[model samples]
Target: MDTTLQDPLVGRLLDGRYRVDARVAVGGMATVYRAVDTRLDRVLALKVMHPDLATDAAFVERFMREAKSVARLAHPNVVGVFDQGADGAYVYLAMEYVAGCTLRDVLRERGALPPRAAFDVLEPVLAALGAAHRAGFVHRDMKPENVLIGDDGRVKVADFGLVRAVGSATDTTGAVLGTVSYLAPEQIEHGTADTRADVYACGVVLYEMLTGAKPHSGDTPAQVLYRHLNTDVPAPSAVVPGLPAELDELVACATARDPEARPYDAVALLALAREARAALSEEQLDAVPPQARAQVRSGAEDRTSVIPRVLPLPVEHTSRLPAPPDPGPAPGRGPVTVHRRTAFLVVAAVLLSLGLGTGVWYINSGQFTRVPAVLGQTEAQATQRLADAGLDVGTTERAYSDVYERGTVMAVDPAPGERIRGNGTVTLTLSRGPRIVKVPNLKGTPLEEAKKALAAEGLAPGVITYAFSRSVAQGAVIGSDPEPGTERSPDSAVALQVSRGAPIEVPDLTGESVPDATATLQEAGLKVVVAAERIHSPEDAGTVAAQSLAEGSRAAKGDTITLTVSKGPRMVAVPDVVGMKTDEARGELEAAGFRVKVEKTFPFLGDTVTGQSVEGGTNAPEGSAVTITIKGL
Candidate 1:
């Protein structure tokens, strides 16, 4: 699609005002050329849409829509669109031309960038995204190909017009747009666009910059979309060991399945990028080779050695045991003072002989084997090493940890091979890693406030569901999954339900006729169902008389309402109660599902069962209670 001309648009005027120069670059949909606005005497980049695309009415409409949308955005990092028009068969956009290679070019030349350099590249991308997001625009097609690195090392994001085309899906069936590898889960699942979607693509670009490879790639775009939907991106640390944990968290947060699960937008991402870069630099210095450290200086003022000092043990009464109680001479030895004195010497000689014999035996048999040190080693390695040292391995316990690799021993008691006797249990304290508590309930809280709460607890944001809620105002969270106050492990997902708008009320027309009622309900945006019933009044015969739930109640769309229709008036023999008091008989009749009609009691029937008509039980339409004529005799 490269257009060459000697006297070509090179100095030739366009639209009788702007003069075009040499072609700069060619792309699938447009050709960029260096041009000058003759009237303003300023340099500009002329981007002419492919003539083929211009022929498609639909593409032209979409391109114009994009142009209109991008024209509203004003951002420093975003390449601005100055003018858009059609001349004869060609459509062109005059834009600000950045005079540098693209991020793709840098990546191709450098293979994999250093951590800091990658951060440098992504920082500006995030900035541009942040600005677009703030301006109510999402850069849907964010990829390295659309990022231009200027000769001044400034990175400017191009192709802002592409967002409108991609975000607004023309096909209702949810087609994938832009580069599939960087598509967010929601974008693929619902054809929904949001700020996080761009954040996700930028994250993939950052990953590519660091690893010299895209985290998600496949043979086809569809395959890539599927992977983005189903697969979790492995942490950068996993691929390149020693990568900063902060960087990994940043990437993971951006690529989270839920849109609200990511950092608020690219604005926050840029801030996090700076912090990650600093932290990584500090870490890299500490991880330098020992030889390098030694060559530096004697007292290099080490910042990493912040661990507190501990005191050494001193030797004192090292092997002492509790003294045994001495026993006095027996009572039977007291025959007299003289007899006692003689008995004392004989007893003393016996004690002295016993003590001398015990001392010789104690020294001969009390040697103990020292416990061997086996802490901080893998289970298999530690077990084998312990066995080789004539020591029996003890039980093992596993726990999640960030410090020790999984299955490594955290510590051992009676450490290694300390010997007392034969069989002994060495209490091993395995590294379970760090403790993690789940995210707490954040519903009803502001998003920023909830995020702060989650950050304090070491948990991350998860899915954010939006729905219209009358109770909860718009933008306010209605509820959250894992519910509020539920404990979760660190990095646990925090789902939120945000309010969309006010809820709509459903009309109650349960008593209306079927045809008339259906029309009325539909007009009021309510669904209806009719059920048959038999009633006594013309108002209740073969017509909807009652509603399942009361009318004027608040309900959302698609809520079902049942209608009770009449099957004409039904009759049955009235229950007989000759003498029972009015209140007592009324309770019994009502409990039996019959409507009660009470008349003033006659003088003789204050509280007695005197007579009966229709007996105690009879078939009825379930609402007939008879009157009692008491004391007619």
Candidate 2:
């Protein structure tokens, strides 16, 4: 279904300027919508605060103040916020629109990545954060979902100014669950965040990239937060064995449970990252880990990553690099003829110097050989090439590949140009074409559990839709697209329909007592909360004045309905204008917050008022009507 069409803002002009087109994403505090600034004729992402939140005048004021501060922070990595405004009940921030997925999406699709690919993403992210940290801003909430990767391969940090709108921890389970996964121990234990906190999150991100999984897992946000407060992040190599020790050290240094033990800031951490990367050999950088899942992507796969997402670098190590010059001959040119007598003399001279000849053979030929480049070659062609280099073919094997064609040599031992023993055999692994997996049945599974199921089968969780279902429990998956047992390539997205339980019609609770309203809502399987502030309304004092949801609107069971109580109509003091001219008295009454009705005794010529309906110096409701009697002339 086109959910955007159902949104009241879609197709409606906001602030008589911005035209909201489509809903892009939803967060706990706001919903991001693709919009256009009609005045400037530019597209932007509109992050509109939830209506319930916008109701708080104090909160909106702080939100705008923080947004203005963030807008002053000009950096390429951070998402640009242009303007902040409110239209009626809607408060929004117009930000630069980036059309792409997030790091969360990439991780969901491809679990572990080769070290080179992981660094390509991590370095740029750290650089962006370094800018933020230096600017005296801390993104208290740093998660993969906030890392935007554009189609043009530019990485940007999002939701910078919005985090301060709420504290580090929230009451919502969904919000806390995603946030707690990346929080540092200090952030979890004390709810304090500084630049080092961001470094901790980056370490967790690196670990996830290296192992294709989070360092910690639990059934609830409390469990995850508890682990963060107590547990130290493990080395990536612990999961993906044989991972470089340098990478392990890097993760350990950044993810140290003690804040003082970690890097001071993202800039410091970025320097450490560079050092770690520099220490890695080409082979270590490009070696795909056992946990790295093959992706069904091709031709600039990093188009989805906003960061510098170049493909995994080819493995090229400088082993046996000290050999003497052996530029034997140039290829594709005519060879000059050599005299037979000259060649015979040279061979005889070498034979006469037996000790020197043996040393020369060992240095140049017998001791070492370079593995010839044969990636993406036919199996037969690779075998011939190996033979030409005086190397033996040890084993022939094939694995499914998304990039290479079947029967082509996709990988080789010792990689290209790496040193191999002169008598060693090179093992060639051929491509078996693309792989496919059947989607598992996930009906009746909880949402979080379903995501795990998809990950287990090397598939990624896709867009989720919520619907009201009677039979299925709330928060449980009703069904999935492509159905169970449907065949799909690895990392293919699977959309799910989750149950919202049965829908309930929200009843009007305005004018009711607080206890009565709460009892009524609780009986209807809905949660109720009274607003923190009371607003002045025509309704009686201490009575329900408004609700978050309109009367008769359909809401899912357990949906929270907020009630706004009234402090009653405002009272204004009446002015002492008795015995004055009728026109003057009428004007004074109206000015003092009263509707005026003048009555002239005869012929309507009595200009002077002897008395007024409201006694002078009396208080009345601000908008109440007041009648005046004029004495007859």
Candidate 3:
């Protein structure tokens, strides 16, 4: 088979207006071509389902539904569908024609794009996906091939609603419809897909764009699928030596095995991609040499003047169609005729019939149908109301609201009572309610105090406690309750604590003179009292000789104790007993309470005192000592 053989659809008229020019791309179920709209004289892309697939009623119904679903989508980055119709054996969709390479083509040509360039490319795709997600459509099979970059550097995402048909078990013709390298972990394992599934695929696309390699791979599709299920995806940095930490983190986040680990949906991923694009480091920018940057600038130049290659269509045996009439002409190539007269007549008849039918439609189109007001109503109510009004309730969307209750209608497009064409769509936005967040208060306070304040504000306080002092005393309320100003729920509790005075220990003042101790005790807020005591020495007179209580005892306040002071010792005088017998002298000294020290100097041999040196009972306090002397014979 000659690869150069042209597709039969090329230059063929479709629906009597669109003329297929060149094949652009072919997928499992459809072949897309560049076409010229004769009626509008504009270039358009046409996707025609394979005749074999269209033969199946189920596939045809799904294809038509998918077309309708995607046609409802309106976004700058998304390719717009113009019309959908069945012409003979062909079911084709006229869509927007973008004249740029697919991101796949770019990837094949340049192994890996710069990290910045990758994000720049992905930003629009994510935006498109986000819009679809918000509209409740999931682009389950997101990949670089579905992305197209225009010569003007505009990015447009294609292939929105066809994924359902591709994933259907009945549609399995053994052709792998999806790019295996990009399937998410759950998409591979459970074959379950959702908005987050799309996010995971987008992450894989970004990874390949950044590192020039898929995060996971195997010898076969099944192996690749297994890898997605079992293995952890390595970061882009691991493949390319020096990718930005943030970009690496983003890739990891996007390709996470757990769907919940990835961004909630494309909208969140789009936000992250935009942030990554803006935050590209100077080093990454500098790494792309001026020459390489120039190539990127120059590669973006228009090359439409040189005819690009047309995508090849699957070879099939052609069945002969009725011949068209030959028009007589006298050019160098004899009578110029294309097809037999019968074929031309049939074609003319079809065109004529369509024109008449369209004219009838135009006249009938003047009929007015009022779109009922369905704002602020539930989906079921809105649908019933629209049905009652002979209008169709089309798209339903969930959106955040500040005033409206959840599940209630936020708004509707093509406002009520407006005249609209037959089967016009009614876009409804459902309310999710305003965002509510618990208040966090930390104001005019120390760290601990602030934390308590926040807790009282109904927010779980994060402790950032650090010792701080203000007019507030140490370890006291620096200032709290609720910080100076913060929004909090009514009747919320605010934490508070009073300050504790500085630490102190009682002073011990034990033994000291009464005068000195009095001064010391007075300074320490203690009073001193004197207790009576007798002293033996004059030097010890009137001093604090003893205390009623021992020292070093703990007392709180106003405790009293007595101290004993000293008076001088009393002196006793000597008593005299002379010229009497020894027993009589001892008796006299004994009566005076003085022990006698007697010495006998008498010449008489008897043991008796003859004389005394001092008289008895001398003036003295208490007992006095007496000295005795005796005369010799």
Best by TM-score: 2
Q: Who is ahead in lDDT, 1 or 3?
A: 3
Give the total clashing residue pairs for model 3: 14
Q: Candidates' TM-scores?
A: 0.41, 0.50, 0.45
Pick the winner on TM-score between candidates 2 and 3.
2
Query: Which portions of model 2 show Cα errors greater than 4 Å?
Result: 1-3, 167-175, 297-633
Candidate 2 per-residue lDDT over residues 1-633, each given as its tens digit: 245866888756788777676788878789998776756655688999999999999999989998998898888878999999999999999999876678887778677778887887888888888988888888878888988876556778898857777744645477677788899998777778899999999999899988988898887887887888888898888899899899999999999999999999999999999999999888888877777655544322233322323433233443332333445545853334234444666676557668665654454334667677676679899889889998999999888876567898666775554557776899999988888899999989999999999999989999999999989999999999989999999999999999999899998888999999999999999999899999876679999989999999999988999999999978889887777887888788887778888777877767777777778888888767888888776
Residues 1-633 of candidate 3: C-alpha lDDT, one tens digit per residue? 122146888646788777665677778778998776756656679999989887888888888888898999999999999999999889989999886678777666556666656766788888999999999888877888899877556789988988677653223233343377777777776778899999989888988877776787655567767788888788877767767788888888888999988899999988887777678755563243111211122221222211112211111223244553455553665432433455677788689768975654343333445566555567888888888766776888887654456887656666443446656678888888754435443333454665565555445543233233334454444433455454444445445443332322234333345687566655554556776554443224565556555565443223455666655334555555555777887887767656567665545466556666555455543334455655455
How would you order the candidates by TM-score, starting with the best? 2, 3, 1
- Count of steric clashes across candidates, in order: 20, 4, 14
Worst window of 10 by summed lDDT in candidate 2: 299-308
Candidate 1 ranges with C-alpha deviation above 4 Å: 1-12, 56-62, 65-69, 166-178, 282-633
